[model samples]
Target: LPASQQEHIFNAAWGGSHKTGQLICNACNQSFSTNVDEVFSLYTTAIMNAWSFKGQRHKSVPIIELDGDYVLEAGAKLRIKPEKPLFEEKNLPNGQIRTKISFNSKGEAKRWLNNGGAESWLGRSLTPEEREYLLSLIKESEPQRREPEPQEASTTLNLRNQYRSSAHTILKCLGFFLPDLVCSPLTQPIRQFARYDEGDWRLFAVEPEQFFSLGEEITNLLGLGVYHNSVEIYWSSSSRMIVGILTLLNRVKRAVIISNNYAGSDKILYVFEDTNLSKKPPTAILAEIDSSKFCQPLLGVQYFAQPTKMYEYFYNELVGLTSIYNPIDAMKAELIKSLEEVNKHHTTLEGSTIDQYQTLYLNFFIKLGKVLQVSVDSVKIDSKLQEYGFSRLRLELKGRNITDPEVESIIVQAFDSVLSDWTQNRL
Candidate 1:
């Protein structure tokens, strides 16, 4: 491989530093970016934006279109994008006309009112007297505040292309970490399928029932959040197979089969990027592991016999995990935001402050209960509080003065106790 032909194997969108090598030719890199990488990136835009992940090239979060006349901006902020000014006029029998106009902001309303919007709605030129009368009748209304609600959106994805992209990514990692193995004849089929889409190869696989459970265990072991991106490649001597597992946001998991009959010694390469820490470069680990540690019995040839069934199973698994994790992530974000707000106003702890903290705690516990498939109520929470010797603190928090140092200490300890239980018991 020449210097000009070498290219960085990892996609910049996955939050990593760029390192060019002889892993892939420049032409193949560009082609894969156009065909495979773009599709997978589009499919993961929401998750990427939600986590505020910025790549080497893409430094800002992209706008996400919603179901209605709104687009998500800067990840969480919603902006209304109506096609036209919102205007309605009703003529009454008593020789009166009632008009209504809506705008996203007061400045927008003022701009529209000055830019012939009134004349357009009236369908005629406005005389000085008419304009003055309209101005006199119109009054500015106060802004309305409402609680945030869930948003619904639909996205069409090509799972086949995404699978290919995953396989290609694994191949790139191998090229960077184990160049000889990636260049060997054993990886030729993967190269043909991932680069040119030439073979009917079973590129990705998962045990439909055990995939999520296994993913959760791995996530806990790695101390990874939903925003982290990680990939693992290992050759299992016992199973005589080379497999690669790709995880995005700790939500989407897929195992790519790189080789079925391997003759090399046991090797494991793990690469990960914490999207939250954009300044840090991605980490790569090449280590020796037990020959039997990462073996997958389910990736045998028989598993690929029914491609349609496998695809369907993978599709359903993706959808189910997305539905379950997205909302929890949102809730977690809200909890963090609320906590920041509390810290910002920490000078005085009033009754309202206690109430706000309790509200935040209740909301988080409810979400945790739902995720754990457990019923949680005040009684159960109080029982835990009793175990922690904070049962009396809860009652004292209500009646005690806001300036009491002991009260604050008790509340903090109780909060810590709850969090400890959650982490220890998998709540």
Candidate 2:
């Protein structure tokens, strides 16, 4: 064969087609001996265990750099600069250093930032005190794992609807789909680990409350642990490797993976466990793996440049080093942030008459007040708008009535614009 034809054949067989590859035997054309066959068999097993094609869909998105403070969607600014280290060296494991501060765009960030700037943060850091405070703010952020009840009746529930009672069923499903995973145990007696399901895996580990707060921007739920509404699962250490195998399994569309870490926080290894996805129904199973361990199905797994270290990076580099500078005198911060915001993209009165203007302006401030967690005194808000040069000058009524819907549209847009500015300044 000509060299070009040979090259074409090799690329077509190995590179273009993931289903097959050519192995060049160096020795004679005869079949392998027993010892060599054994070694090769194990090699093929390892290869089969690690082979994945889902990597083709891995799309990296931009990172929203939270350089310093956190700004809310309602234009509230939180200056986060920690006064001291959140955790001392003794508190962390020996030789475990905090991840360094840096910017990145990979994994779930693509989905989070897909709205351009709606669900992003300039910074995500918090002081130890702020971290505790935020824990209180979002009460369900960290849930304690509950003791597992007696192995209940397992169900044939799909990945989306499974619960604590269905954990064993999920494990069975995992084992059914990929039996080799259960056979090769990193730790013995696989019944001791807890399971989580994160649907539509993303890279960064944002708390459920914050991630969900983005509304439609974040479609799938991250980690649903043992606590019924919680996202973290605590199980015995022995079966931990099972979760890693679940991450390697094929992703189910529209389902979430449960985990302490955010979905897509790890580099996803696409095991081509089943390739004929369009033709075949999704893989399902029902068999008990271990009595002590629980399982939660994953929509998919997460990955970053460094998968294992993503949690550390988020905690230490993003949240630990930053403080929530909630000053007792936040009035000035609020006033200035809002003032600066209005100057850039101030709202104009689109309705005629003082009543229309007042209604629209009042509604905008009221919306803002809720986000800033402050009272919207109508008089004070009017005065503030006047100070920012928003004219209450009436216009002639020519178009449709300025209803609540119009006011809502105007206010939401203004809120996003002002908040975007406030957040940009903090960064």
Candidate 3:
């Protein structure tokens, strides 16, 4: 927690300690909890991400910065409170709003801006190069290239058959075709284009005539969305073809179905996430980002540009052996718990002190992190021993090779699987 942390909407320090908590979004009318730190991280990342990408130009290169203050609506209060003693909206010592409320009752926890920065959700900005680098971190498995726009696609039986054949041929080429509609100028299938929304972050806009034209191209080019190698053909008279197209596309990708009703095409552009050029999938060549709790908010804020956030995200993605699929930082956290148990028995261990029983403490907790298979990064021991004076126990997280070769292979495979699942195939 920082000295100036605050939560207009709750900035959850949720997972650091394990008492359990609550996140209540009054505007969204939603309240839920799993672990505090995990949830808050996910929320911050997702929401801030929206601010990062929204309203920016879709240049060949990304300008990694906040999408401006489009998301900071006044009067929005996302609060996280201690569910144990009944939910309470916490306040800072100086009576400031501590939106990222802390359970420890520490004076530091306040708002990101209190330390002096931008009028931003994350309170800071990144340089052009760094921002571009972070945007690349978004893992685009397949990068989409822009070419001269294809003409209005004609779906005559012959053309449809040819397109269908072309689709299969592309599959044989070992990848799927993706249809990302850029609805800036708003011409064709504007309604269906509107249906595709980016929830947390915002998007760049498309030219007007490009709307229905893109929809027509998608209708003719890839058929409808795929389900396995088979394409999904949908047509309904309900609400216009625009509404019908949206209704169907919603079932195909939830990430595109935000904003309830389409908000005219002044500000939305879709990215076709992936397509492999080898080994055709037997199923729909899926090429959309799965709705991520991590991406929703963080991209929208300036804080994501900070060094601290960079380290935190890196720690999770490259080093997190626990949080990927589990969502709850449970594994790393579960292993950390020995400290709490020690805290109970030993009672007090804070301030400038040293542990007298250095050897005993190390010997007992030494096997703890090893058992969990994650390194313990710097453990502090307080209390002065007889002549040596108070000593600190510092253990930096170290990556070690497992002694057994076969077990090492299995661990590596598990790690690979986790990485594959968590990473979005976007470019």
Candidate 4:
């Protein structure tokens, strides 16, 4: 391919700064985008929107669909988007009809009413007096507020396409970073599989144990916080394979085999970018892989059954990482972190500090209530309970200058009790 026909190795949607280079041919790059990158982008964007990971192109939060008549916005705000007005009618004992209406917004209700919504429900044309009265009632009545439970957006992905896309990226990374080995005979299998879809090779693996352990080390070194995009390419001497790992928003992970029968010295190229655009630009790190430190077994093409395991493991990791799928645990972890921060800063919580802690506590409780299917109004710290549970924890901390080891114990106990109660409801 000529220079003009070359395309970016890293997807620009990932907000990587190193996208300027000519790494792959335009035809092959466009093919990957059409076949696999689009679906991969959609899958990652849902998580990115939920976690607020801003990309280069998608600077604004994209609206994502949730369960029922709700849609989740960028900042985790759930907005109801009912297709039609919901009404609940009851016969009062005084022979009067009591009606309640629900709409996505007050404006929607007005528009529906203006377009003869009320008359259709009444089964007759309304008089001027009745129409005016209904409008007045709608204006005066306070809108009922209900919190929608957070649910993970459902996504259908072609596993074969995902595997191919991952391998294609690895090949592009190789072309950009390790040009010498990219066109070698050993890499032909990967190239053919990624570009032409000519092989039934196991192109990728989703081994959480290997991914997380190495991911921690890479993130720590790069100072890329919780949500970031990363790609690592290295030659494994023990396995005699050139491997690549791709991570998006620090959540989606894939390990791709670039070449299994490589004859090269140890080489490492780690590229990463913080999804939060304000922090840093894309960076490339060079290092040598120590054979002793890298003992991960090579995943060769002979393992035909590994693809099924990879699919299962990928979804399992996704569910655990996304907060919507596991809000209770997410909230619990956040609450624990908040308490720990408070304990670390203040010797004895008082005044504004106490207020801050209470604010965090209340916010957590409100979310927990929604997850538990309990109304927000019922999420209160009742003093009648003797057990040191959610409600009792606040009372236990009141006016106490206790900032010792017992604080941790109390937190653990409170979380355990809450978990027990939550599990009782099968939440």
Q: Which candidate comes out best when scored by lDDT?
A: 1
Report lDDT (Cα) of residue 363, candidate 1: 74
lDDT of 3 by residue, 1-427 (tens): 2213211111112111111112112321111122111222322232222222111112211121223212211111112222221123667799876432222122121222233322253356756674545345333223333332212211112212222222222211221222222222222232232222212111211011112222334444543321111222111112111111111111111111112233322221221211122222223322222223222321111223454764474355322321231222222233224334443454333221123233333433343344344443323311212212222112211122223344233323433343242233210
lDDT scores in order: 0.65, 0.28, 0.25, 0.62
Displacement of the residue 259 alpha carbon in candidate 1, Å: 1.1
The true-versus-predicted C-alpha distance at residue 10 of model 3, in Å, is: 4.7
> Better model by TM-score, 1 or 3?
1
> What TM-score does candidate 1 get on C-alpha atoms?
0.72
Score residue 39 of candidate 2 by CA lDDT: 22
Model 4 weakest lDDT span, ten residues long? 377-386
| Alpha-carbon RMSD to native, per candidate | 6.4, 26.8, 26.3, 8.0
Task: For candidate 1, write residues 186-241 as lDDT tens digits.
Answer: 88887777888876645444332221233345566676766567777766665678
Q: Could you tell me the lDDT of residue 238 within candidate 2?
A: 31
- Which segments of candidate 3 are over 4 A away from where they belong? 1-365, 368-389, 392-427
Model 1, global lDDT: 0.65
> What lDDT does candidate 1 reach at residue 23?
68
